[model samples]
Target: MPVTHTYNEEHYCKSKRERRNHRMKVGFIGTGSMGGLLIDAFLSSGGLLAGDVIASNRSPQKLARLAQLHPGITLAESNGETASRSDILFLCVKPMEFKTLTDEIAHCLRSEQIVVSITSPVQIYHLESVLPSKIAKIIPSITHSVYSGTSLCVLGSRLEADDRTQLLKLMSHIGTPVEIYEHHTRISSDFSSCGPAFLSYFIERWIEAAVEATGIDHTLAGKLAGEMLLGTGKLLTEGEFTPQQLQDRVAVPGGITAEALNHLRCSLDGVFERLIATTHKKYDEDVAKLDSLFGRDGITRRK
Candidate 1:
């Protein structure tokens, strides 16, 4: 099932010595929001070079936009082409599109290539049925674009030692890679991937409240709140302080900050519990739908 591929004869790094200097050619299928962000993070962080990458999208305009932003990168005419030409292929399409996308490119994927899925609901066992290549699932975050935060990795049975090493090394350039059990994917993603949006929403509302209460300019309020958040993140990451410890340090006894903290604790008491429950409910529904598509007979749950 290995498909043959041809490269430009005039392309650089063709000589034996130059070939040794060449890096792996990474291909991305479906350059939507997360896919595009991952590509940008890898390139901007120097984890991958533009010339060594090929990307394809369902939308021509999206692919054109990527080419415009990154001049030297190659654009594939189809998903099958992207699958056949790369050492590492990333399937970044939606959860529902996984089956059709994998079916389309399955013949082109070789045992030597590593195929990674960024969609959470499509597990490795589901992918194992279709792709002959080594498979992995990486739940990435928007924060990776800034080369920070955690990315969850769950390696499949086919992955070799070297494959795991190479994948983790690439992830380290963008974010810390935390390998977790299959069952933990949903909860882990909720904290790492969805955490950004949740925090941002909270901050947005926080800023709005300040603007309404004091009649301060909205732009100024946003700048103040944003910088506060940036500084708080730096402290949490670089400083030797747990979140609770930092909160205690800032909210001194009988102070304005302490009063605000007391109010917030009361207001947010059941908020997060409800948030997690709601997210997990939706996740269960999605997994149920996927389960119906891929039947549950042989899927191994790591627990």
Candidate 2:
């Protein structure tokens, strides 16, 4: 028996047309290093057109450079105007500036628009108090410019399903979008968003030691270490090999790798423990400081 299938050409054509003409308005309130990187990544991802991006920064010099880099990006007259013109707004200012920036643009934020906090310490409460609706947070990485990073997102209370889907679609083109709880935002941000710099710092230290110990050129030592780390990253991400498994694989019972591993274990006993603990504690303290400023109401600043 032959089954006859009906082709809905009109529906298919309409979908194609929508995809061809779709565009979203994006706004950035700060245009610093992280802020500027995001704009470039977003535009390059083709999620949003450069002309639809509205950028505003405190520094005219930075704005001038950004405009030179991407002339299509709209330079808004004010933060409020940027918020007013955007369907999705990103606050890239410092955490301390969150309250002030929110106060500045709150009146301009439409009820239907989404305001995302790209900085830490500012929570949903702080954003909701003034913006009243669609308050969300994201911790995106500088590595997003390379299209390989983790973007930790915490959705707002009123965000629509369609909106979340659209956001994921736009962001995932640049990096992996992972939803995280606000309580774990600090740890997650530290591990993914802030991990690159921390890793690079250690790599530099290792490279210096390798050059000194082996009498190899610093350039060659650094390149070797970098390639090893890059391959390890791929194996961890693409292969089934766990960090512990890979370590044990190289650290055979009494091999040279084992000796090196043993020294690392002894040397790093409480160093990483305290370092990580301090990171979490610092984040909590900063959040507490911001909370004190906003009080329970999250609007009134501390005198």
Pick the lDDT winner.
1
TM-score of each: 0.90, 0.89
lDDT of 1 by residue, 7-65 (tens): 33245215667645768899999999999998999999999999989999988999999
Tell me which residue pairs clash in candidate 2: none
Could you tell me which 10 consecutive residues in candidate 1 have the lowest summed lDDT?
Answer: 4-13
Q: Who wins the TM-score comparison?
A: 1
RMSD of 1: 3.3
Q: In model 2, which regions exceed 4 Å deviation?
A: 1-22, 298-303
Taking the tens digit of each residue's C-alpha lDDT, what string does model 2 give over 1-303?
A: 121212232432235457457566789999998899899898888767888899888878898898998878899888877877677888999888887887677766656677889876788777776675487888899889989879998887789898799778878988999998888888888888888889999999988888789888998888888899879988888977999999988889988999989999999999878877988898878888878766776264321
lDDT of each: 0.87, 0.80
Residue 100 C-alpha lDDT in model 1: 81
Worst 10 residues of 2 by lDDT: 1-10
**What's the C-alpha lDDT at position 109 in model 1?**
71
Q: What's each prediction's clash count? A: 0, 0
